[model samples]
Target: MDHLTFKLGRPVTRTTSQFIVYPAESPDAVRHAVRLGLASPEIADGLLSPGRIRLSLTATLVAQAAPGRPQVVALELPRPGVGLDLRQGSAAPAHVLSRFFGPPPWTERYRQAWAEIANLLRAGDVTDTSVVVLTAGEPDRAAAVAEGLILGSYAFDRYLGYRRKPSTERCVRLAGSVEAGEMRQLARRAITVAESVNFARDLVNTPAKDLGPQELEDAAAELARDLGLKCRSMTPAQLRKRGLEGIAAVGQGSPRSPRLIVLEYAPARPRYRIALVGKGVTFDSGGLSLKDGKGMEVMKKDMAGAAACLGALRAAAMMELPVQLTVFIPAAENMPDGTAQRPGDIIRCGSKTIEVTNTDAEGRLILADALVLAQEQGHDAIVDVATLTGEAGRTFGNVLSPVLGNDWTWVERLLSAGLTAHERFWPLPLLAEYREPMLGEIADLKNASQMGGYTAGSILAGAFLAEFSPKTPWVHLDIANTSWSAADLGYLRKGATGVGVRVLVQLLRDLAAESVGSEARRRPRPRAATHA
Candidate 1:
């Protein structure tokens, strides 16, 4: 792991490199400053700019000179009278500053600044740290910079070789008043949470060859053991005995076999029972309705939801929230084989029969069984997360997860929690009328819709899962857009985003509070009968 340290001192009288900024209209002054700044005879002549500045400084210089020892660019802003120093890589120095001042709406501006800085850090191209000096003397601005730098320096590099090492410690220094100890603690906590999220991403990024259905189940079981949670892993035979046809039929094609992973975290005084179901299609080859080459390239991340659920459970156990939690992972790989279920096959799923209209639509089938199992265990509220449909990506475009639920209040609560977690979600309606199209003439319901396909894919999938949770307040998160990122954003890299873990954690916390309050408000009644 890389480390960053900051120090402060008096400004050096001698200058090395200068970056002069004049009034926006004074282009000539900028040219003069640049020319003087590059005046050293040892420096390349082409770098002496007579007029205007180039944005691609490094690329232009590299193209001009024969490669040897790389030249370092040290930037300095010319200021007279009072002097201040910004130094890094040392311990405590005289008057170290760590404070932030921004717009009146502090948190939003703070987040935006962090987002911008995080994007730069993740780019991996720029080697120099950006130093901003504020003359306004606002304490919050300096605090925000320190906070952003602390959060922005997170990276996911678990797969790196032992021989490889990063050359520099990425550092951002703030020049304002703030307590060093408090800032250090804040930075440590931020990095801890970010690393946990990155761990989830690593699990999602692993190839199906290394992490198949059984392997995923084993991983979950190990996690439960490590956290001291009660865990039970059901084999295909056990699941079959429990009448989990949805999981059995979808997993029949894979040699690795399928499993139902149940993990329980019970606190000493439980407030609420919350169950989370995740679609764990470790590798989705689209089954008999095979996917195209481009579509199959990233299918290893199809288990992203399961990864999030497992990650949330780990965080919850670590945080020790006052909630009884249960996690259900229906692990399977949807592949094409001689024994694979066909598109027209009829399967009984948790007391409800489903006609397989498309073998590619396998995620919902697996989740149906998991939801039924959760409800049977007497959970008050159920939530399932999955990268279920391409329609979600088409609708939200990598920005938002679409949430659908039969209970409007629960959906709203989840939406609010997602906002606070920075995991964006849009509440989608579960119209009772949409159930008509899902009705099958030969079976209880059709897995794929005959009409309104792309427009309502998320809603239809939610409706399908809702069948199993007949009495439980159910929420379905179609996180197809958020699970994989086409580009990096903030602390997230351009791979598995680990979308739902934080949101699910927040939701669990909210549910726990609500359950506690509700129980406290109930009136006591006199006992009518006593049996001895």
Candidate 2:
């Protein structure tokens, strides 16, 4: 697939093929467009009628421009009816505009506006044209235009015969404070992240029969080796030797066995060490507690968490971020067989024993050993990602995953990083109140919190993993819903969403940047992406 490239250049006047992207965030923004020559003052006045405004994306304004005049492609804000409350140009009108256009969370509507811009370009099949993005002041908001374009350009039709690559590789020229070189750099970064996301997407979309623990480990090893990161993998016996019984237990049913794969990128004298553990259930059949056929169909994507970690580590290494990182993937295919773990079976996970009450909840079991291993390594902080529960999906849907942890500050920072990266999360309270249901009568903990009335299955899963590392500044990301989608949404294909990779990569970048800032720093230079 041909990747879209954005080139930054000094702004200039143009005609014919030229397209203008104007943000109609507020009435004042519309007027500002006039002041910037993006629109006529009369056009700004016309916006007051509401009828003149296009409610979604850049729509062509015919007879709106004279011969030789640049085409005005106005981007309409989502939910256009509510934003124009006469208080638009008040003292602190930015508060109104921001509130209206930039909701505190995922301003997905705003992104949709941007996505629609791509939709316009793609629809027209306009190729090799320069798109001049117009905005007044707000450079951050301006940058989001580039973000949405790249996002909207994402496609994963490689398996299909008639698959066509995203059309129109336009030159994206930003008419703002962001330098062309900077915009080029941001595009490169976004592309690298997107490519990794697509990499995870490919991994999760592959059939589990062809992508067992060994294949998953081989992929990680190849990525680590090519990216200059250290790679190591443990066989089922090695896992048993290391006392990772919980990970080994669920895989006993499958002939493929399990693997404990570790990839490390240790830069010299790195300021902080970050450890990430991902649940890599290549395919899940729910073991002895088999899931119904409907529930088992999409089990191949269960390894999305592991794919995400691999993608994040590869991106960080590819970007040469100055942070030491370690990623653990407890990979296996959970199936029901004669030797499969039973409902009442017990397995040793790190220092504690967990009773398997529901084999369908096998994600947490593998993650248990991986989390303990990460915490034991003395990393500065640890975070685990898993598609561990259906309740999480039921509660949050495919929008924001649930984040829980003991360290509120770290959770807040990670979630904020997710927000900034456009991979949002909603914080679920990790109250002590949630832990009561996790206790196991026969063992230290139970893999399944099937106790009646405890409908917070996602939270209880987090609570169960919490038993591994009690005091580490750890964060838990339950990506049960966000990992895959039945319908495509901006940059996300219908299958694996490559959910956590961007957020985790963003977190590492932010940490690396934060460290550099504290020491009289400079933004790390971008490097060429590593090839297979």
Candidate 3:
């Protein structure tokens, strides 16, 4: 795939093969066109009218210029309808253009808008674009544009016979007055973060045949070596010797052995130490309790949480964040065979024993040992993400993942980070009563709760893992729904949304800021952002 190269400066006038992009709402777009001698102000204004161009999420007004004039492209915003409401009896008059539409969160809207701009360019078969971002004087908004463009352009067509070739060397030139140095820095940061997200997407989109436990460990080790970080992997024999029977049993049926992949970034004199645990069920066939035919098709995506941690670790290393971080992935494949684990099987997961009430509920069993390993190292906090339940998907429905944790502070921090990254999460209560359903008759707990009959299944899975890290501040993100999209929406591609990676990167950046008492630490983050 070709990555985007960003440049800042005004381009010299050219008649042929020249296109300029502008925000429709910005009067400056028309003024700039007039200044560039592409069109008269009145002509440019007419080009942007609703009747002149069709607009859904976005619209483009393509103008054929005179021999020496450059072609003009205006990016139209959605008219007031559906999501946009007109507030009645407000101080601002309805006729006021800016106030005509109700206030959606401007920051996120800018991000989504720019992502649409990217889609518009792609539709036009334009790989290189000259864009004028109307940030309304906020320079930080420019970074959002860079982020949206990179994310919206992601595609996973590696397995296809004839795939659309991704742009190999695209360029986006920003023509603006923002300080050149600052623009470059912001753009670089956004590029690093978005590219990390795409890396995770690639991992999740890969077929299970090629990305089993050992391959996943190899990917982590390669990342660690490239970034100059520490990497270690534990084989099935080692895992069993170290008292991680849950991980060992889940993969015993498969030809491939399970692996515990550990990656670490330890900065000297670090202010905080954090552990991230991810459930890496490379292929979840539901074990002895096999899934239906249709359900099994997307089982390759079951390891999205592990891909997320790997992506975040890559970003932290590239960005050189100050906090010390460790990532743990308990990689396995849950396939049914003669040697597969069965219902009523009891497995020792570190300090606790779990009854395998349902072999399909295997993600939490592996994560249970990982959480124990995280706490064993005595990190400040632990966050584990997994595609652990169908209930979470049915509840959230690809909108936001559900998060349940032992500590409210850690939960709120994740929520705040999600808002900034635009990869959202919703908090679910970890009720004291939620723990009762997992209490096992023969073991310490049941891997799947039968008493509740699938009621609160997502929280029950979280409660099962929470038993291992009883003392550490822990947050569990159930990302089954958000990890892979059923259809393309906004910046997310059709598959492997790479949900938690951005949230983790943003969280680490926030923690790094708070570590040294930077000015960003004083700025309050919204508990959540309004999702479209």
Candidate 4:
């Protein structure tokens, strides 16, 4: 893990650096550029009007070698991407930022962009402690730019033999009266979140041999203990006694049997209580319905949902959000052996019998039992996150996560939280029309659609889990596409994305706020003096 540090210092007029970054707010307003002594007004204007500056209708970034500033190189700062419209007309702040910020408003996008900038500066022989991130406009937004750099430069290379020492120690100086304390706190929280996200990615990146069901349980228990939260894991005997047959069926193929991990965050009189269930298939080989060698290569990440839920739990514990959270992870490995579950096998999940039509559709089976357990435990809402379907990826690409649920309000709340956290989501229907396709001839339901697995797979998976949810509001997040990056996307590198940590953290915070506001409204206010 590459740990990042930040320092806050007063702004200065004339600073010397091998590289200087300038935000191009307006081409006509060259006062700041003139003040920085980059060039004379006429010269700067002439140099900036070239094809590089005027090529794009969207904001532009122009970097050039400064003529008289010795070794100094200047880069023009602009919004991240070109012509992105996330607001299909919604006036949400996150959407507004997404539309205008050039970058897709995802923190990782900003992080990735800034990381690249730092690499460029380092590659250009600017091996100093810090780079000057000078910006235009309100100047306060410089903190955001600073955060991007801090988070984007993160890397996980412990398993690799080589380590590259990074230059640029701390001071991310910008021209503003930004509160040093607030800036530090921002960086600190960003570091915490970044570390947690990276931790999740690490778990996902680890091979199944090292991170099996038992190993993942141990990791979760360690995180819980360190975070000062309560942790407990149900052994195979316990799961079997409680009739968690779906879980048993999935893990029986492996010598390392299934375990149900439960972690609790109970603050002093928590304002709200919520349940979270994450799918944890440590290594999925699709059981008897085996996948090809290429398909099974990345199966270690089938547990990303579980990793994300654990990461979110860690964040909530650190932030001490005024909410009680119960996290349930159904950990298992789907392997092919004599003991492995086969297609058409009947497995009992809670009170319902599920006919395993396709052993590949095993995630929802374990999730069903966990969700039922969450409901029995009592909570205001229940949410399950999973990398459950490839069809979802084919539909939305890797840009947006898909959400399906029974409650409109909870679904909408999750979507809103996603936008606010910059982990955007889109809603999919759990339509009654498709619910019928999940029925099994011999059992209460089928693990998969008998017709085929391709059509509306994600939503059908949600429908299957819905059978086990409590009367409380429940939401299902399908992050199949958003769980990994093929290449570096700003803040995120080419590995596990740790996609759900921030979104769930934000959701808990919102629930805490709602709880506080509701309490305040109920409190007795002073009866106005109505003396006639």
Candidate 5:
């Protein structure tokens, strides 16, 4: 399974059974190899020729129609020796290779394709041979391959004991030559991000019976302690004193109390102060409004945004980004009980009051308190992540996250980061006209909209968040859609996709770099100001 790269003229040796991709489809070479019994021209023709062929698992010996050999081998374009064709490189070619090698048990060809691509990325090159290396054999070439395989193999099968073992395949490996240092760094970063995402996924996947608001607070505190960051948790009384009525009201009905947990990481020479607020509704029973049986099934994932924020913080701290970061998580559960906040209840937030038209619209209420606290800390910019609206899912589906921000520059930068990370987000308008729906007669605003159903729920939520920070640069991420996927694709596994963690980390890194550059520009000239 060792991967080696050489130019065409170099001496070629194959000690063990190996697969090679030739550049040309010359009949002469095929005939010669067939005569020497070195390869099977028919098998080679089947693979090298255009069009897809799905060989049965029972089929043996892809190289020859001979008995007791490897099952069907798939081959496609650019032949072997012809240079890399970026246009022709695809999962189809890789699948052919997977069929040839026949991966180990419980592994899928798609996962192998991902591993192959990751290997090529680590090698820092892309060409015709790169595709072959990705598909032809076991991924033993680069350390980065190990990293990607470990990452793509994650599964949340903890609750599936009674169900039959899923036939779904997982696991991938890559083979290619790569620079050791760069490969190691890539592997390390991939592991760091994957582990963080897995952490978030685990938290989201946990049953509500075990991970209540208090438990979530403890988990955050533990993460802070482990990362050597400052952590603080506010009790119900403290929340009431701070006028965090939104969070308090939501949690009053549950046996588990509400908490406002803050984690801070201050660099020595901070360039910019960034605040992240997350809505951590551990479980959403929809309070007095009450969700039906169907709506309640996935209520465990309501805290997905909070989990992502926490995961991003962990990654940032681990990477030691040179920015002052403050993470605020308002952890609570919206449950139905005699003491629960009713639909008609009016709660006073930090700077304004909000009337609750629907108890299910509780995420915004908790975020209201958290955002106020973030602004009070005097952050230069703020980003809040929430599983706040189903309208977001209906609008953007599961692939794209909807982002609303006041600052165009920040929003653009975030979108760039999302693209680089392969996560998707679309910026939505925050028009002044949308503000009217949230206005309340008695209170400053209402959590539920008076009109405009799913058409603009994401934008409306963002408009509500804008009320707390009138002047501060802010971005609201409504990740209701991208947080989880029922099906697998690319490197993403099903359930708790941990979609925003990488994008957030990348954004923070970019922000830190910009802050450093700004600081350099703002440095005081010697004696110039005093003379002036």
Candidate 6:
């Protein structure tokens, strides 16, 4: 069963195997337990020892109890920095019949705590559950709890075969302080975002053999159909005809070929228009400039940028955000073959020509065509995300992603969105001098900087894309480092992390809100008139 089946309800008398979780900081814990009917004030006082709470077990079993009192399990909040340890044995109860949760304050750590809870839930495969989330009645805080659980419950075990088990049918009931209607709305929004993020993660985790350029196109087309969005695609020949040769040249070596997928969502009244361009290198073998075996192991994740855009589009459409969103994915497989475009090759990218200096530097080439396409469509702003450079990985070390852009306003806007979404991004300058190395002797520009070697590789790649959208407000994210995690950390597992989706969705949300406020200010007021 899917992990998203959740409901909201009022707290009731405890059934067998119920989990009563509350903040240790809550005043009169014993009194609260008596009211919930889990224990009498005298018994509850003995159940919790301030010293034992932190030093003892994560969960204490209240086995068979007296006739009147309920036999419910008790879990007191652990001290700060101590994680939730809910990984009970397989022989444990099948369902969480009920829960009494007094969620802690909504801090960054609090958000992470909820996510870790979700991870534990998924790991244990607890079934037919009902979670009572109290304390965080405010909309945003409540949503944070929901997001943490949903995102943490995400697992990519499709290929696990006999080892894989279906997700348990889980339910969460929100209670306390918050109104029922508001809680329901918050839950829906959080679920939408989590579903989209997991969708992107699935795409990234799939192997290249199963998800080539054509398969990626099929996925995008299917999502567009499901979401009622406008979808368009261009074949290799069509790309060449439109002078988008950079994309065609990159995929010429691979038999799977290349295609460009465009997904558009235009609401009845759009407040803002923006284009999202993502690099869709299904497998980056680096063409003739082949990478080592170690470098190519995770090459399948090269298409994570496209996955991010598709995922963001899904959330934006589901939420029905008042924005005109256009997504451009330049899909290709950069494999080395006799037909592949080698170094010293000249390719046309829109009106500009790019010299293939390093065939491994193929992401910028494809993005150049897609960015120009966005510009031709006259988008108000453009944001392109790609797993583009190893230099980015070396610089950030998975802690953050590097972003470079021609416009500070858009750059700052994206950074702000990252902060709100809990994604980290550090801005790098598009230094004018960096552009010189990109200038080519044979073509208008070279894909890689010959003189600079690997110096500022991420910045130089961003500079290459900046050429196509010079006049438009644009920001480029080199997510090479943050897209895939090396090990399971916090709520994120040891695979594709779906980094860019949150930032993109948050950016759209902020833009929509700003547009509404601006329009409100611009609206004309009805003025009282004297009798004429």
Two-way TM-score contest, 2 vs 5, winner: 2
> What TM-score does prediction 5 earn?
0.73
Q: Please report the candidate that would top lDDT against the real structure.
A: 6
RMSD of each: 12.3, 9.7, 8.8, 10.7, 11.3, 8.9
Name every residue pair that clashes in candidate 1: 99-142, 99-143, 100-140, 100-141, 100-142, 100-143, 100-144, 101-140, 101-141, 101-142
Please rank every candidate by TM-score, starting with the best. Answer: 6, 3, 4, 2, 5, 1
Tens digit of per-residue lDDT, candidate 1, span 128-246: 33333222223343344443443344444545578333434333322222243444444443333444465577678878899998788778878888889988888878877887788
- Tens digit of per-residue lDDT, candidate 2, span 1-532: 1123442110001111222233344332232232222232222333545444322121122112111222223322333342222212111111111123544443455455666555545444433432334443444445456555555545544455665543334543334333444444554676567567767877888888789999999999888878877899877787777777987898999999898999999987776788999889999988888889999899998998998998898788888888899999999889889988888988888778888888888888888888888888877778898888888889987778998776666787788899778888988766666666777898988777744665788878877887786646688899989999898676564778888998998888878877444642332221111010
Which consecutive 10 residues in model 4 have the weakest lDDT in total? 7-16
Query: How do the residues 288-379 of candidate 3 rate in per-residue lDDT, one tens digit apiece?
Result: 99999999999999999999999999988899988899999999999999999999999898877888989999998889888888989988
Tens digit of per-residue lDDT, candidate 5, span 1-532? 2222211100011111122222122332232111111122223324333444222321222232221221112232223232112112222122233323232331234335544443333233333222222222222323223434444545565566775233321112222233334444554565566567777887887899989988898888889989999999888789889887888999998989998988899878877788988889999999999999998988889998889899999988888888789999999999999999998789899879899999999998999888888878778788899999998888888878999877776677679888756567998887777888889998889898845643477878888888887656788889888887777665556677787887888788777776456653242222211101
What is the C-alpha local distance difference test score of each model? 0.65, 0.67, 0.71, 0.66, 0.65, 0.72
Q: Which of candidates 2 and 5 reaches a greater lDDT?
A: 2
In terms of lDDT, the poorest run of 10 residues in model 6 is 7-16
Candidate number that wins on TM-score, 3 or 4: 3
Q: On residues 134-244, what C-alpha lDDT tens digit does candidate 4 reach at each position?
A: 333433244445545544544555455555443333323233223444444554565455556666777888888999998999998899879888889887678768777
Per-residue CA lDDT of model 6 for 196-265, tens digit only, reads 8778888999999999999999999999999998898999798888898988888999999799999999
Backbone clashes, candidate 6: 0
| lDDT at residue 512 of model 6 (Cα atoms) | 84
TM per candidate = 0.72, 0.77, 0.81, 0.78, 0.73, 0.81
Which TM-score value belongs to model 3? 0.81
Better of 3 and 5 by TM-score: 3
Sort every candidate by lDDT, greatest first: 6, 3, 2, 4, 5, 1
